[model samples]
Target: MAKDHYSVLGVQRTAKPDEIQRAYRKLARKYHPDVNREPDAADKFKEIGEAYNTLSDPETRARYDRFGSDYRHYASSGAGPGGNGGRWGPRAGARPGRGGYGNVEVDMGGDVDWEDLLGGWFRQQAGGPAQGTDHEAELWLTLEEAVRGGKRTVRLAQPDGATSNYVVDVPPGVLDGQRIRLAGQGGPGREGGPQGDLLLTMRIQPDSRYRLKGRDIYVDLPVTPSEAALGAKIKTQAPAGTVTITVPSSSSSGRRLRLRGQGMPNPRGLPGNLYAEIKIMVPPSLSKEERKLYEKIGSVSDFNPREER
Candidate 1:
């Protein structure tokens, strides 16, 4: 008995064209002989191709819907939906003795070209070896790692309960959501064709010290109350390293000091800038000398912060 084409493709009889195509692609990728070494994989792949070929075409699908598995026989014999001797006949302009059913021409004696029938990737596969499908994965990295590009080892979990490790070369200044393509590292090709690429999307891990917005880097610059009142040179940590920046005199909290080109580096264009946001800090408890000095300053100075506000 012939197998149901819709069942073979794992789709409903009423499945849409795009749905059928998607199912075919997924099953073909899973059971392709080059990818799946199981004994039944090749047979399964061929069955999927045949099902797709029969159902992908609108005319063929209509006939299949009407005639089920025997659609081919009915198509070639000019039989109606009922049986072999049903009342369906050739169309008005169909050539006689051509085995025509409606407008479709049935080829009686030629070898079927599954490649042409299947189309898309199968067409390429029929010509020769077929390139494998590309694969995508997320690769999480620290902000420091993104800033300093280098080789790092990554482990990917496979479908068969195993893991594959790869040493990936990360590019400098790689931003969050950026994809890096590793050539010939994706799904294996069929019949010795070239392998596809493995695309790794960069996911920068959250850091307490640094926050990123586009190419710009923002870091909190903590300053003492004295430093904010009477400008001072402070050493703060940056992605590159520790750097000394002089705070402007009378600098207040929430002030932003921009460091040009000290942010994320851009290989193609201008590098991003780093913004240092000032955050004032004070001692939890003041010493006796500090209290005396504060009392004296309170008596001498007329700086009322509330009045200014």
Candidate 2:
């Protein structure tokens, strides 16, 4: 049997929200497809992600606790009341042809798709032409791709039991949870009605280079001792390309340098800014001359960084 949400997250059923989040972050970092090379890393990551999403939301978590995974929507549609299945069919005098609706019967005795079952009942009660239900799926993009916008291809399982491919035209400045719509790409309409849409929700993959907040980006800008001491112009990675920016003299770690309009671009309006934080680094190994020079400077200078401490 498959693992439950708590099992997947390595948490108890009574785990607190913060505890759940902590466990999720630890597992995500370890199993993330981009980070782990294990054969099952991608699948495990997806499973944990689904587990975290379900457990993090109170309403959904309650629903899951009550009815298991199918409780998502299926169980709710099961035999509305008193276990009498449901009332679903075309209305009387309704046209049945190419120009109008048609008859598509099913044997709901053994097994059936509850999603389709619910849709049919809804359509019959509406007493009018109804479009198919919209489908939702997630699309993961790299940090660079989310900023630049490009063609991303996705393969989905069609209603007819076949997988089809589509090239999504991702827009620039896309962020996590942003929805992109694809018209008439979802479930097929019944009785010649128009098809529904497919919606793709964007999720920028976790990047080690930068952190994102809305439109702005934060990145670590490493500098050598000389560069931080005397100031220097250094080339660094930006959302768009490599750009040179100057660091002020006597800079310290955690100092932020802003690059205006160098962040995610907007298709409609002004772009966001990128903030580079200074991180001074020293060479791990030193040559004889380099060691001598450092010793001399130490003897000549009376700088005490630990005075405050």
Candidate 3:
């Protein structure tokens, strides 16, 4: 058997409409699954919704008072509330999945009214807009996206069994772990409150070619043995674009050449620097001509690469 509407709402059988509303709001705020961690909170909130929806309507309340939940079924199904006919469900707000109060926090969007004054002054609900707990989600960005500052779309699966695609603007110089807010996109609120904002924590995806620290970026600058030893101007990829860098004469692998203001653009202050670390690469397979050239250099030059400085 369904619980009595009055008992479910913790209200007197003679409770006034406002009183019932206040009580329902209070319970909804207390038991809403978005804010409350209790296993049965969703069920409790749903029960409160059912009670409020039934008792708030004059016709339903009168019919319920005269008969019972059995009569409620008949009334909802086009029959009078006095007879037991068909079992029926409550209105939208009563069902957790049906009305959308499970995973969203809603603030009373417009101006305060009698409901607000009554809810606040009586402490039936908090003084501020009735809201649910804050929620968090992860947002992954590429190094290019983070440095360049642009927009990206992300798919989010919410707690109340809802999935959505949200577009977010990525600000220039956004750092990892930074949070972006999408207003009114979080858990549902009690009654007619506005939804809470969804917070996204930015994460820069790992790239083999680039390593980022704060605003600075590091990248590998590959050069041949001939180029490193004799010095040359070679082009390499940077956060912003490709740039030519001059290698010092007799340069070795692991040497870093700095590029100012080329790492990441700063929206408020000085931009980060880019470092191009030199890596000497050798050909995996050498032809007869290359091997003959290497043998010629080895035979002529007495340079010992392993000798300590």
TM-score computed on alpha carbons, candidate 1: 0.63
TM-score of 2: 0.61
lDDT of 3: 0.71
What number of clashing residue pairs does each candidate have, in the order they appear? 0, 0, 12
For all candidates in order, the CA lDDT equals 0.74, 0.74, 0.71
lDDT of 1 by residue, 222-259 (tens): 99878998899999999878878889988888999999
- Give the TM-scores of the predictions, in the order they appear: 0.63, 0.61, 0.59
The clash tally of candidate 3 reads: 12
Tens-digit lDDT track of model 2 for 174-279: 9889999999986566456788788888989999998988789888999998799899999998868898889999898999999999988878888889999999
Clashing pairs in 2: none
lDDT of 3 by residue, 200-298 (tens): 889889999999987889999989989998999998777677888999988889999988888878888999999899999999999999999989999
Q: What does the lDDT read for residue 155 in candidate 2?
A: 73
Go through the candidates in order and give the C-alpha RMSD of each one to the true structure.
Answer: 9.8, 11.4, 14.0
